[model samples]
Target: MSREPNQRLAALMAEAGASNKGLAKRVRETGLRHGRRVGTTHVTVQRWLNGGGIQPETASLVAEALSSKLQRRITPTDLGFPTAASSPVAVAPSYATSLPDTLDVLDRLAQQSLDDEQSSGVLLPESEVNSAVLSWLISHPDTLRVDVPAQRRVGMRDVAAIRTAGQMFMRLDFLYGGGHGHKALRHYFRQEVLPLLSASYSAKVGNALFGAATEISQLLGWTAYDTGNHALANRYLLSTLRLTKAIDDRMMGARILSNMSHQANYLGQISRATQLARAATEGGKGRATPRAMAMYAAHEARALSSAQDHTSAARAMNEAEKHLERADSAEDPDWLSYVDEAELVGEFCHCFRDLGRGPESLRYAERAVALTDPQYARTLGFCRMVLAQSQLLNGELEAAVTTAGLAVEGGDALQSARFQRYVSDFQRDVSSHAGVPAVQAFNTKVRDALADLDDE
Candidate 1:
């Protein structure tokens, strides 16, 4: 069967005022930078412009070349290419035995993420997530050596600096939300971390460096998710998981998987969310802290509730509570310190809300709001929104309106898209009651606050 002509590509070419030969030449040069020896010529470019297709790899190179020439991002889809047919370029699998191969993959990923054109509209497929999880489960740790010569000798101090920077960014994210510091993190990763990965080091220093990288990558994924960039979040998370498995860090791997499950659930991928959460538990096995296990179970419970499996959800919720009861904060990893009882209660509130149990949701929501720290402004706002929804569900319309107004008052403090989503959901919930004076006033306040936030 013959395919239709790609009129979009022709139009783009006309807009760019690019001759076929000039475009082909530029693509070949761009391919060389990516280590791809593309054989595209004027004739091939003409064929593409005339509705004929090119190889997926060639299409990607063409998009990159055009993006550079046009001074903006260009994607294969923009050129009327079927992205589904293109096989993504495979990096060395996270389970690969070669340390250099793993570093190379990380370098490429960082570069791709920095490229605005390539990063935009790219989705991490469900199959990739499943495959990564499977590999993490089955792969054995490689005997790593870091003997390669480099511009500088990396040391323990460098590793500590990375960890310290990660902690700082984590605190910033928690206080102000991911959107507050994600770009700066990305910049630091590209400028500082990427070079360190290539520096010469002993086996001990190399292990520590990779460990810090893994942690930083996980944080990066979390911030991306907070900003509603799920595809980028998934990529960073999968990268982190591979690094953790490579180092035989089961606890960290479990944490990464738990985060992945959260992002999956948020995107309405309930099945994948459940699978990832189960994998987190399995990966942790005997290695994870009680607190970590509780976090994993809490995520599973939320997914189950979202899937409307009330029986399983309740069971998972109980399991989470039991584990949390046994959790000792002093004995847990610093990363897992944030998963306290209050956080678990908040998760329970979310699960019950999803299950349409309004009273349970309200009870937990109130407790979570009281337990949450004042520094966590975004979380407080979110909890308030949850409380408002529960009130509305229970037919306490006036109380709901008042709680929602408080949510709006705090909205300006958060930079999270997730928080904005909660605000939007609250708006929708009260839309039917717009005839009520309180509802109308609440709606007006929320709209004005959102507009102010946008302006800032």
Candidate 2:
């Protein structure tokens, strides 16, 4: 079938006084800045002008390039492209300034995510990540008057129930991965939690209610991340930050920033990841508990290592350890109770693994594995992958394969896309030693494991 010409794009280009070659050049330069290799040429521009469809990713690049040249926002729709809500490069939802507005956005996001299964594969744009982090860093508390007259009254008990349910879902996420109960969690939030936002409640109860909502938002973001719905994860995280701002909870704000940083790092936005992590540390400074601070610092170290800044990474790791040493679990919020010695060490293992510090990473990976409980299946699978990679970097090919096989076995029980990515990464790493019998056997095991997962 023939497609209509992108007349809107042509008009925009004419208005901006941009030539096909110039616009293509700008798109390539923009992609390079974002660490993407865009190969759009003037011929491709002509094809688009002739009503040829552009890929969602390239449409974003074109929109961005034109927006910069024209000094205005130009969306994909403006270029006559159908809106790609699930596109990895789609613009993110802007930060909301009011509590009701934030709740509206959250409700919409949940509904959209539930309706569209493709939301699971969307990537959060780098610009949106930076914008949300910066906004949270500078934002102040909005008025907390949530006592709207509703048929149902929201009390502390209602808030407590929300918290309890959120905690239960969180535990399930940690153990079986995000795919386990993600749909149920979203349903609970939409049906059970959002209604309370508009219900009548006292000032004290309102603040606590928003706080509880923030925790649930954060968990939703995390599980989305685990299940590979990165764009949806970012939306939830942005909402979480907005809720924190309404409650004036600096510690929660910092925690949300850290979560955003983790997603950034996972998506290869190293600079954005580092910036968000630094913001977390700064925002959490006098307000966060010792364990929380340690978690922030560990994430910073991980980003630094990815950037190949060995010295700064080590320094950040040491800072994290020092904070961990001072942490008292009794003072920690229930949400942060999980960050202990094992978690910090797991961060250490990742940092060293990224920096190619084989021996140190191997030791930390081993310790992390030993310290992690059996119930935390997802975390254990990740730790094992790190150990296997560490062994490979140390030239212990046989040991690496053996460890990798164990990791695959553990992964059999996980419903996480992140865990599968880890398995793929490990498989790629060991491919260099394909001649080895152990490596070959491990490859077979991974293939079988993935097949079983797909069948399920």
Candidate 3:
């Protein structure tokens, strides 16, 4: 069977400044380090680049050679080669059978996510996502290994450091968008968190440490989603689910499922989104606080609205509203702090908009805008955009233009690809009214703002 060229591998080679002959020689040297006399050459490298299949061991050698040159971890997956992670065996029944296996997967995924050159435009198949969710839902947690042989003996202080760093990264992500600080966050995870995971720790420390890791992994997934690296986001989320399960954080695991549902809805996998959201809601029954429960219900409403399940969607939205009214922040996980009134209103706006309830959408959108904190730039921008869309749908073209203009102004500061899509969507929605003075002006504003964003 003819295969497409390995653009991912080619991109990595370019980034490593490795020519065909040079990379082949490096691969051979790496093989020699493993007690193998591999006969790799420029021809072999060219063939590999041209979509010729490589042995798994040879692929590892290639990855090792690139990692040595780049001074960072490079797995076979990063080079678009089939690894245990991608193969049927790796993802077949579950994510992994042990804590170390989960860590291995997380390490490889973090490396792949950090390599923007390699991961750009790559989206994993929906089948893979389905498999991941299924595995998480059915698989039991592996045996926890708190006692590990390593240089450092970790404690609560170390776990607190990891949690603090993750919280800081989360704040930055919320404020400036994922593209703004994703690289630095990934570097922190690899440099700071990775060592802690490998260090000696008691069960107490391990639970706290893994909890922090779960938070970081979830943020990594969210940031990846914001930056349009959906496949990487999916991988990170799966790792997070594994971590949550290992730590026996049932509520946190439910939250991860809710996030997966949101991503699935965004990807147009309506059925899967609904299933995942329902799973989250059911699983969170006894474990989640009201605020966390609200989040799960809201995501379910989102998927239901997209699927046009009007009655079911309304029921879920009502449930979300009720939960939010009783939400006690102190009782909820720190990660769920962002899912406050404004966030719930935003979800309501989204559901109404998707359900074609323009008037209701406008109400929720306006409330979302009013309730949103200015520091949350991306959320405010999103609310404004939703308001503009609702206005346009309600035939208030001038009002739509004004709202869209504000969206452009606020959203342009964000480095998020999703925010850019919001701009594009509003622009497309308003393109029909281009003859109107306000619409034309808004169009001009969009053009200038997008140009500036591109230049930056």
Candidate 4:
């Protein structure tokens, strides 16, 4: 697809009064200071202004160069480049220590994300994902107390409000898809939650606040991922990890890691996804309930399947089922209430499909669809697509077309980019059978449904 010019970058350069030659010279000079050879020229700067992205390393150096000249922290995102190329704009001292520092980072990121000019279509690099997973794994418990001075004192009610907001947003995301409510969630965080973080509180209250914030942040990340903003999602997940670690909330941290693994898997970084899934399991050890463990194991199985390691993937799936058998809803965290048999079966359908086990995939997909709540329109839609794909793989072309039509019907009720992509994928999968009358009718229904969605 042809990309529009990076007018944001051009505007920044114009505002800074930096000519292409000047910026190019600054980049080379900055690269020299970092002991790297940069071959940037005026033409290179021109291309960047024209929507051509630079290498991640180059983007980092360019941000630094601009920061020096502008006397501020100018991130690659601010320059309209994909954030995957940039190191986090603001990182805490360490994930293991300092709640104040971590909160500061969160505040900055939340603010940046709220900006009207924030770039889109940014992805998180595989290397960044691996780095974040490693950080989470080695992070230790903080012993220091948080005692920030503020005009008002935080109470349990304040903490409860944040938690309640998180839960509310989570429900909205679950039923309607993340794109429906993520912006409002972010607004609530910036307006309501961030103030709580800054308020005066005892160590106990601070810990509670951080824990609640972690949950909300992770949800924001998941929503971003669901809506196809992978780079922002990665940053939010990392922030969630740091906040959870600061409060010594390993279970939440593990959940956040699992969420990251899902994003990585979708992005085709199967190896990184596996690493993150393993990290989630390790982090949750001794704390997470069996339900949580089952979720983690299922995510790992999906990652392994993506890597084409069918033997290991099957073993992981078996392990996931074992954990699921031991799960009790009463013993699990509220966050894990969604990880029931249907969810597990949905994941298994994905895992088996990725492993080329068509019959197994079809069976699990059918079970998932049958068990899925009607309110979960997006999930049901995706499961139907999975079922249709399996049907096609099993040489049931007529059944596949019928299932795809049902999938489109389910998908038409949602506003998720991810769901739309799933529908598109199913469309491509059944393209070979387009000559079939059912297939043609299904395609027409999907096209009209998608057009309606676009209009909305």
Candidate 5:
């Protein structure tokens, strides 16, 4: 029914010097922006070259994906389909709704997420409409309509679909990781989403898209961070920060910027960290939820720690504490409840450790360890690791070794290379004290774990 998917894919392949597998990886990344999980295996990218028609509905995704990576525009018809609109004459109406409604939808979706991982039924009123979008997001990135063309009626339905795709992109990128399939995402953001955002985001649709993109971009940055692609992560963060104005989703932008501060601190860009954190603090000046204020303060403290500004860091930590007390008073931001007291304490412990204030670090670390609820397993693991590291340096090798084991156990459930890197760092620290029996045992456990992973 459709012509060949597009000449652009083949042409673009030539430009990027991408092999079949590379292209496959890119496709998976782009598909993720729409909440699909495509991989870099042979079958998926191969299907496209063979003219194995894709579902028509996913053409936008394909178009977005190709356009972004090649640094050029791509079309749906270029991918072997009719355009998103039928006949090109009967087009969907431009949706320019209020910003508040868009955010309300986002808020509602996040609330529903607590109950369901693959969340839905919160954004749209029509069950059928929400369900269709849901199916699109979770499906394989390449498994969509190149042949079975379907015309979508634009309205609440289209908005819901877009939001759903955006959310899926954010969540999956965080869970499995952004590096797993990122080229595709980079392309989609550059092409499909950018143009749409540029054309006319209603206060309504614009805010939603802005918020969604901000979240997704942060996830992309996280992937960059994890994979040690600092330049790429910084560039993405800069780009997303530019979108903060038009987006009107203050909380999302602030949190993302705070994340940038985190990355900057990690990369030892202390001035940049200070700027970003301070800016985020300024951005959310009036509406300070405990989470938001704490996030901002955490950023500031991290920056100060990196600068070795202990006085300022301590002050910022105090400010963070004050702000956290207000988190319950303000409305919850989508991603920030994860930044609770335990997280604050963990951040504080890290700051103190960096400043070489061992006793204070230990105090906060113990408090952090005490706060580890089962649901917050990841945060708890990190805190314990911090305690161990500080203890090791403070001449408490036995206690450090003990806490380090708990940290490693906590990390076992995470399956992250970055997490593993932290665990490995602690292991390395423990091994330096090989004469200590507990340290030797800890070293043995980590060495064995590394070997096990290698054998796999």
Candidate 6:
């Protein structure tokens, strides 16, 4: 029931001075940093210690902790195999095929299932495999096609099933943010999903299948971004962009590019970020509502501000505000259904916070937090951190520290690398205020968390 010799676990724990809680907390935190799902705590740890079981994610975590502590190679086998599972559900391998076949597989499903599986309403005569079928599938824009007609394969699923998968991912993303959602979706991409994308399907079916892939890729991109895999995140983002173009979802495409801009700026690729933001705005074409336009402009403003171009920033800011005004007067597209008046302030405030415009940023930060959904714990956590930074810079030490503490509480409950970076940044700033009691308290807490992470 153990991977490495059981003797080592106790020895390493004693050498590192980590209690079971401390070790588990550290493992969970580090697991998150490396991209893993680690829900359940005391009970899970109890089971593992009581020779229950641990997943590959847990194995990797234990391996990481042991290697660091013992200065030697270690792996999941060192922990325990427990009858050898097929794989960790989070890191399943991938399968890819061309457009039509993938679509055909997704659109094919059984009748009267809870999954409501259905294939393309039109039957593709298996006897004739030609381009005509492909063209017809694409030209027919109706949602009537539920399952691909009459094809049977274990890997093949109905459109409804694909949609159900999408919904599942969307729900997880909503509940846990992309950080946790990415790995789950990635497993799908690696296993039953991506292989289909590798095959060649007719253009019509291909596009439909591509549409599903695009959403999955978008989620993958989002998860990677949220988990701090910048390079992989950008790769998935670009893939999503290309897929959206093939499927002609300019709105979604533009949104992905806008997000890319943020990532570029984060990585200090200022010009690239600016260019991408501009391209995103342009890509939106007439689809950009006042709100969408404003949001897009704000993304550009954020990039420009990062590059320290005040003139461009001002111009972009003005245009963004104008766009926001227009949004107030216009009917938004379905994709932009979530954006509203408060979101505008929140977006601009976020850009300002990043630009280090303390007072103005604080105003926007407060408004955004007030307007943001409580379920969006990560966003709220980042907002609180922004507010803390502003307050700290403005000499409101007590308020800053208290706000930072709240951010910590919010952060602890979620798994996000960006939030961690935000905390790290806050910690760096507070280090300069070491003499203050609030700063001291905050630093102590951060160190404790960091230490716990080290133990894992």
TM-score of 4: 0.77
Model 2 ranges with Cα > 4 A deviation: 1-92, 114-125
In model 1, the runs with Cα more than 4 Å from the true position are 1-102, 108-115
lDDT of 4 at 96: 21
| Residue pairs with backbone atoms closer than 3 Å in model 2 (clashes) | 5-51, 120-229
**Cα lDDT computed for each candidate against the true fold:** 0.78, 0.82, 0.80, 0.77, 0.59, 0.61
| Pairs in steric clash, model 3 | none
- For 1-456, candidate 5 gives per-residue lDDT tens digits of 754654555665666677778766766775664467754455665676666655543554555556565433355555555544132211111111222212212222222211233331221122332232233223332111111111321234445655566556555544444444455555555444443432333345544555565655566556565555554455444444444444344566567667777876776667767877876787667645667878788879988988999899989999999888877877874656467887888889989988988888899889988986655554566678889888877889888889888776553423455656667788776666678788778777776766775575
Residue 179 Cα positional deviation in candidate 3, in Å, after optimal superposition: 0.6
Per-residue C-alpha lDDT of model 4 across residues 1-456, encoded as one tens digit per residue: 886899878876886789999999989986776567899999999999888877866876676677556433355666888763334433221232245445545655565552234525455566765676677677676542456444678888998988888888888887778888887888788678866765678888878887887888888888888888777777788777877876678888899889888998998888888988989988888888888989999999999999999898989899899999999643865677788899999999998888888999999999998999977777888898889888888989899889878877765344777887877888888787679888889888988887877898
Residue range 1-456, candidate 6, lDDT tens digits: 453434445545666676677777767765665466576365565566556656655665665555454333234454554433234323211110222222222221101111111211222222221222223223322221223332332232544456579768765765556666564566676455554544434556655565666677676766666766654565456545544544566667678878888887877778778977887788776865678878788889989888878788879888888887777687754435556666566667767766778889888878877887766566677778887887876778788889988877664434667777888888888777789887888888877765665464
Which candidate's lDDT is highest? 2
Q: What lDDT would candidate 4 get against the real structure?
A: 0.77
Better of 2 and 6 by lDDT: 2
TM-score of each: 0.78, 0.78, 0.79, 0.77, 0.61, 0.61
Give the winner by TM-score. Answer: 3
Alpha-carbon lDDT of model 5: 0.59
What's model 3's overall lDDT? 0.80
Candidate with better lDDT, 1 vs 4:
1
Write the residue-wise lDDT of candidate 3 on 299-409 in tens digits: 999999999999999999999999998896438667888988899999999999999999999999999999999878888888898999999889898898899898888
Error of 6 at 10 (Å): 58
lDDT of 4 at 423: 77
**Taking the tens digit of each residue's C-alpha lDDT, what string does model 2 give over 1-456?**
787788988998998898999999988986775568988999999999998877887787687677666543355666888754245452236675456446645765666553365455555566766676777777667765555545778889999999999899989988888878888888899779877776678899988898888888888889888888887888888778887987789999999888888988988889988998999999999889889999999999989999999999999999999999999743887898789899999989999999999999999999999999878788889999899899989988888889878888886444888988888898888777788888788888888878888897
Alpha-carbon shift of residue 190 in model 4 (angstroms): 1.1
